[model samples]
Target: MRRAARARIDLNALRHNLSVARAAAPGSRVMAVIKADAYGHGMREAARALAGLSDAFAVSCVQEAAVLREAGITQPLVVLQGFKDDAELVEVVRLDAQTVLHEPGQLACLESSHLETPPAVWLKLDTGMHRLGFAPVEAAALVQRLRTGDLVAGHPGLMTHLACADEPARPESETQLRAFDEAVAGLPGEQSIANSAAVLRMPAAHRDWVRPGIMLYGASPLIGVSAESMGLRPVMTVGAPVVAVKPLRPGDAVGYGGTYVCERPRTLAIVAIGYGDGYPRHAPSGTPVLVRGHRCPLMGRVSMDMLGVDVTDVPDVRVGDMATLWGEGLPVDEIAEVAGTISYELLCSVGGRLQAEYVES
Candidate 1:
């Protein structure tokens, strides 16, 4: 069946983006983050595409790691959240996956686990991001314990999350980096503090391993900087066909609740994509969409399975013409701005119902 709406996953672009991350952090090992299904690009497929290039793969949990393992991915898998319980710890050990011990409870779980051979562990320090990890003061003690503990396979690496790396002007990243350095003073093992933004901007934070998430999927982590500016190529392009075209007279309202009223006679092309297909429902009129490779303004509310785009200025618009919601010519960030959201949400929210086609080149 020919699907009217589809998401094209460019594997080559994915590879290119990874290279960009690597280039930014030339000395650091790359842990390609494929969590949230590689931000909705399909987990196993992304793992396969990056298997040879990426030094390691990082996921949100052990289950995601198991998925990669089941798919025959041999690269080291790092569970960012670590094991939730003893059972998960066992599974982590069984799969030979590395786990991040973010809290005392996770450490306790690991200590109590009966697994004869525990997987390698990374100790997460709560430098400034209060969301996870042990306190900076507590990091040294935990590292000491992990070093002597039976559960850890080798010298555990140290890591921390950056709270404001995206905002380059902010001092929060520097604060976090200083705290991390102080916390891990005189400590053995590798260090990792740079995320996508830090990998690109903060050279001092680029430690032994750098975890690049959204950047690997071709989205910029920093504000005022574009992915293209960072030499990153978009990996996903959402395309749908125009299903119908209507010529509306002046004062004609379009879509539900008549939210958008046309002031001038215009040609509106109904596209076979909508909130149901992960297009943001809150996207306001004037959001940009590409019709016949020309920019067109989105009109009216995005419905469940269709959206209206003003294609009057776009020449040769017709039924079955391709309309790009985001990606390629149209940046997802622009659409996200119109939707009053972020590119992360838009990319991750790509609907499961949309057919995904993977391209190598």
Candidate 2:
């Protein structure tokens, strides 16, 4: 634990975020999205922490779902991308996992295979994303096919991904919701249309199920909105200890490329975290890094194993002192904004090199 980068995961914060999701959609079942290694919080750890609170766990594929099952998680696992092939279909069936049939080929595969045990299914509609799922116009026919052909154990639940639910100003969320509603009119199955943004902002989109993803990790799903304003507590606090302190004279340079030239004498601290530990390489000068809870400006190019921070404003900076990269005093959103990316990318980009410390407080 000496002078190294560490990602401290607060389990209690995760529980609090789940409560926020629950309080927002009181009547809907919560399908906590834990894909991409639970957004780099460690999938097995996330599953263990959210097991009882989450109604079900949603992963990107059979492989991630398999990891959860191997970790002894008993909650219903939803394979969002569904199976990749016949072998995957068999594995999905074996895992007793719920699969989403989004394309005609997947539907055809299920119908023709005639496996001994059929998987519980959800029919995904494209609505407006135009990425995956069947067309909205074809929802009824597909649901009927799943029912009449005995391709699933029961009525297939209906789900659609929101193309622009995070952008509250956009008309796409409402349009997609309307399309989804029209597509499944009078269908007997449960419906899910609300992702994290929809869950908090558009209660109308909260149907029989609500899928909470980034918000579950205490990151804001909407643009320009702060997670702190939404009562979400950061679950992961990444900190790196100061390894060196250099006195900078006027015109002195720091980091790779010498992008930062000192205008005035300053105290610079080198922290033991950089792009190699998943810190954004492109995060420019002036990005906030918390030193003793005070904001410090990042100087020059981020290196592979270290970053330079201007800690002159803070008194008595020294080696072994920790600088918070994000979380706790800082929100991941702020870093993502300066890094020219989204919170999902920043969180998912966290590397395995850092020491992981789990905390409940």
Candidate 3:
């Protein structure tokens, strides 16, 4: 807890974000995506915080699901990426986690298993992402096969992922949705397609289930917009402490690579966070960071353990002053933009070393 770097998660903000998803996609069951440790906000803690609010928990692997189960979280979990080996086959059943079957070998694995029970399976259709899931024709055939094979007698669902829903104006959104519809036509089970982007933009895609990932963490999928713009709040504030203070002369470069030259004599504060802690290395000079509630421009190449910021405008900024990388009043989207990525990457890439402080409203 004494470390200069930390990420404080607002458990209440996480709850509020889930509430927002529930309201946005009314009448549909909500499955909160907690993969990558709830996008690096701590899986068990985030699952515990959202235990009652979420209809189900979703993670990428059985290990993540087991963490929730160990914490007494009994909500049904759907593995976004299905099993890798037969060992997971038993774990899926034992953990009672559902899985998305996207490969031919997975179906064979399920068919070969003689266990008394098989975990519920969600058929994943490629739709348009083309990353995972079966082709439209193959997906249809697989669904029929599962229905006939008794592989998922108790529960079954159809799920698809969106690649361009974040850009509402992109034609791929509708194309993917239509492809998913055609693939699952006449299938007698629940349907899910929307991620945070679709939930906020493509209402028609909101079907029986809404799998919201980034939105649950209170960050926007679309650039230059926020949940508040859509009536939501940010959940996590990655904070660090000012470790060093130095006065820089005009034209003097600030950090390694000398990419940033001091425009004027200014006091620069070095924050104890950098690419090693998952702060983007691509973050160019002049990227904004919050110090003492004042906006300061990040003024150098991000190093392994520290980054320099121009704090000339921030009154009373000193060593050990709290600097907010994002959250609270700071918009994560703004920081993510400076990092040349989306909020999702910034949130998920935060390393495990950062101490997480969960604050319930």
Candidate 4:
């Protein structure tokens, strides 16, 4: 049996999320973002779970692509960050993975490399994000350069990430879309601009391939509608067992900072999970934690190895009672809100200290 803290992963939910992505962007191919260990849902398990469902898998580095290849995932894995050095190009090509070329430096490296054949590349255009990608004119020129000469092989596509697609009302999305459309208008093989947010909100941005990250794990990228409501199920459940229980008197300070002082006599259950275990230590007081299937409010500052939960309403909760930090009845977004972050951070930041159980479909 696993210890007090365990992370239960549901493979069925992963597949469901991919289907949701497909349904959202009916015309575009889906690229499942499995970077950061599938956003902390376990890369191999997530890849296995999403096998065949996702058109291609996307990761940040060549090493991640290699990991997927070693795990027998033969899908066309796209390296979003492209290669860091020329040496990584061989391994990337050997693994049959695609790379994203966003900067002049990467293209220069590719130009300088000696390969039997050039790998397929996805050209990222700087529509609006400004973080990574070539400007509109520069992007068009590069495509012409690659096509005119044999500097690169395989199909080259245009891809741009949305900056504010989460909020559909924002005019920036439309502006970016227009810019992207204009930039890749006549000089492209395919266009991919939609992320998880754009796929759900901006239908016009769904060009050739949609790269979805959080939505594949059933986390809501937008505020109003959740992935589950769109027929997606959560894949990760973070739970820990109560290790200690004690009665707290009124006015008793709880945990560090004395942030939460008991206003009434209440029974506190100390769960065996904390910052060290990847539970957000900055989570504010009154954060909801599931205890014995009941909603229990957190009492104080989260420690390095334990957090105090007020289980006063639960009549006879024990030290071995289970607490869900997020997942199942407790949504990751809700927990993220309390932690002053988003579900993406909460899910991906989950440390390797806890035991993980992979449930296959």
* Clash number by candidate, in order: 0, 0, 1, 0
The reply for model 2, stretches above 4 Å from the true place, is: 1-3
The model with the greater lDDT, 1 or 3, is 1
Q: Best candidate per lDDT, number?
A: 2
What TM-score do all the candidates reach, one by one?
Answer: 0.98, 0.98, 0.96, 0.97
List residue ranges in candidate 1 displaced over 4 A.
1-3
Residue 44, candidate 3: C-alpha displacement in angstroms: 0.5
Of the two candidates 3 and 4, the one with more favorable TM-score, higher being better, is 4
Candidate 3, residues 1-361: lDDT per residue as tens digits? 2356888888888998888888888978999999998898889888889888899988998888888888899999998888888888889899888988888888888888886886798888888898988898776577767867577755468888999987888899899888988877887788999998888888899999999999888888765566678777888889999999988998998888798887789999999998889889889888888898888888879998889999987788889898888888888888887787888899998866678888876
Q: Superposing all C-alpha atoms, what RMSD in Å does each candidate have to the true structure?
A: 1.2, 1.3, 1.6, 1.5
What TM-score, to 2 decimals, does candidate 3 have? Answer: 0.96
Candidate 4 lDDT by residue in tens digits, 210-272: 999988887898876766677768889998988999999999999888889888999999999
**Residue 80, model 1: Cα distance from true site in angstroms:** 0.6
Query: How far off is residue 204 in model 1, in Å?
Result: 0.5
lDDT of 4: 0.87
> What is candidate 2's lDDT per residue for 235-292, written digit by digit as tens?
9889999999989999999877889999999999999998988999999999999998
On TM-score, the stronger of 1 and 3 is 1
lDDT of 1 at 82: 91
- Model 1 residue 3 CA deviation in Å: 4.5
lDDT of 2: 0.92
The parts of candidate 4 lying over 4 Å away from their true place are 1-3
